[model samples]
Target: MKITVMTADEQFITLDVDPEESVENVKALLEVETRVSLQQQQLLFNGKEMRNAERLSSVGVRDNDLVMMVLHTSAPSSRAPTNDLSFHPDGSAINPGAFQQHVRRDSDMMAQLLQRDPALAQAILGSDLNGLQNLLRERHQQRLELRRQQEEEMALMYADPFDVESQKKIEAAIRQKGIDENWAAALEYNPEAFARVIMLYVDMEVNGVPLKAFVDSGAQSTIISKSCAERCGLLRLLDQRYKGIAHGVGQTEILGRIHVAPIKIGNIFYPCSFMVLDAPNMEFLFGLDMLRKHQCIIDLKENVLRVGGGEVSVPFLQEKDIPTHFLDESRYSKQGSLGPGSLPESSGAKEKNDNMPTGSRSSGTTLSDPTRGPEFEAKIAKLVDLGFGREAVIQALSLFNGNEEQAAGFLFGG
Candidate 1:
């Protein structure tokens, strides 16, 4: 297990050691890397001193946990050593010697940099300190040069537009400024479009098996996958008379409907029904029908699902805790067929072309490739008149499937 040991000087030393190892062994390892004697080392975890004989696990130390190390001097000194080094909060060392020492001890950071830049690794590993010092100086100068260039560009943006000498620069600056304003307006009006949507989910049990039910109020009926129903032994209660194809944004075949089952949410069990779908990707969906029937409240402010008219409250899963596979929309789209309201295929559609790419959707009347037709050229010209670049307008239109409003919104940073 890897654990971080932070010194009193705020320097972090990550150590990969076993949880069952004695605390004394950890101090001994720190002594070799930190140049501090084991006798001068005092390890503290969670504000409590750790005993030398005690194992790290017995004292509540886990993987990636932090342990504080304080150093003590055997004798008082009038002056500090020139070699003594400290670290800044951003992880930069005060001196090249400190950085070299840290890089040698941190295997994870070394392995990452080794993969990224071999020249950087060579400089750090070199015996001569001048190479490392020169490398750091070059990096510092590069950052300063970038900052100077940005400042000069900003000055040109604010320069007089009517002046003859700076006409070209002023025109370019004005175009960029218009794009910036459009982006800012879109962000202010619709911030939700830029936010990461955390789907609401509540913990519940079907019969005796635990399950996480997604709360989607837009759905007409509570639905469960056929595999989930079979796992819960509820397939016997399925009524095949209600089986049909559901049409909406997409279409899915409904296998059947379960009449009723006891669903345990929190401490109470409520009678709930489910429409079984043949989908294997999704486990369960808590739709509007069951939510309204149970008088459930989806409290956005508190971020909890209130079941049984506020009688039981269940917290929604956080972004980090949500299942990775559930976030993939492409998997669901592959299983669905075209709905009734879908647009017709383009007139240029090729019949049974073996050269066609797999999983590619049929393009409509508006051409995705600008070279395909004059209609796309006309549309691009109309959008470019609104002060956006010709290339940007073409890309936005293609991305949005030729929807003018949605394309404009995307170009404005939505």
Candidate 2:
């Protein structure tokens, strides 16, 4: 079979040989044909370094196929080469263009060599073949040494910790880890410790009455204050059968639930159901149920609440625009302890105990009703001093007929 061999200098050598011929035999033939020594010739077929024992047919070589030849630096031959392009006689300058094309053919190797040894660029440009070859050899050896050191380090990493050599590395690694952890901890700041974030609220209208709706995904059911419901004309729609206690960070009396109400958000009215709680501070809460039913997405990235699967986006109220009452942490801090009295009475909504029997009164009513004896006043003061809200203490006392133990139990959710 006839095959062509392309030299690094782009010279072609056509040879007729057997398909079963070994790669070493082919190199010997190339040496005789090109006058280059066999030891200096490196054979590559299809970009793979061919083994000496690999046959032409076994290496996937066929008729008319091309193999590449790379010549490396070696001792001078006894007989001077006549037509070899890589070698020059008596310090003759190599062809700069041919040398550049040869190096550029393997872009990765050329880049690595240039990065490791910047002077390689000058050598290539100067057409100094011997100098370029020496620089490449030095860089290659340095790379091999670096690889050997890395392999040794990796081996040591898994070696016995009790070994004398490994002890220093282990100690150094532990010290480095501690230093890194300390640095990270020093740079980390907890926002809750130094600052408070404003609650998320959006402008919404319920039954023609405008109100701020607190967007709380953490709330399982949507809720609205009884006063807000009455203001929005939704009080008439409340189903008293759903009357129960609403439990969260604190427990509150749920008067009833509004079965259905239209809440207008950004010109779009969405049907929303609300559990009517006697809460005084927050007028409305947009909870998870409505969020999921409406396909709402709380996009913190854009700082907006996306409704109807992103069809509409409503921006939350800014800090300056948000009501100061909602931003007061101290009011909420005494939540469960204060009971109904914990709620502000600025609005005209009746106290939570308004529905209770005439004989019982909430703390708010007890405080104003001078007819109550001094003994009742002392009991209320005692419970209030114990961190229980005055209204809650009075209600508890009423439920237990003024028995402090039972009332304390009731106050603690017993």
Indicate the residue-level lDDT of 290 in model 1: 89
lDDT of 2 by residue, 1-414 (tens): 889898777766677778987887787666535546666788998899898788999999999999999986864553323333343332222443454554455454355446644687667656666776565556446544655765555666898978986888777667767976864674475223223345588999998899888887755567789999999998989877666554322456878778798999888999999978877766888877899999999998899999999888899989898787876544553453112212212111123444445564334321232114687678889779768888777665543334565555455542
Model 1 weakest 10-residue run by lDDT: 340-349
Which candidate tops lDDT?
A: 1
Q: Write the per-residue lDDT of candidate 1 for residues 319-370, one digit (tens) a residue.
A: 6776777754334434442211111122111112223355532222321322
**TM-score list, all predictions:** 0.42, 0.38
lDDT of 2: 0.66
In candidate 1, stretches whose alpha carbon ends up further than 4 angstroms from where it belongs are 1-179, 185-193, 337-414
Candidate 2 error regions (>4 Å): 1-193, 337-414
Clashing pairs in 2: 337-389
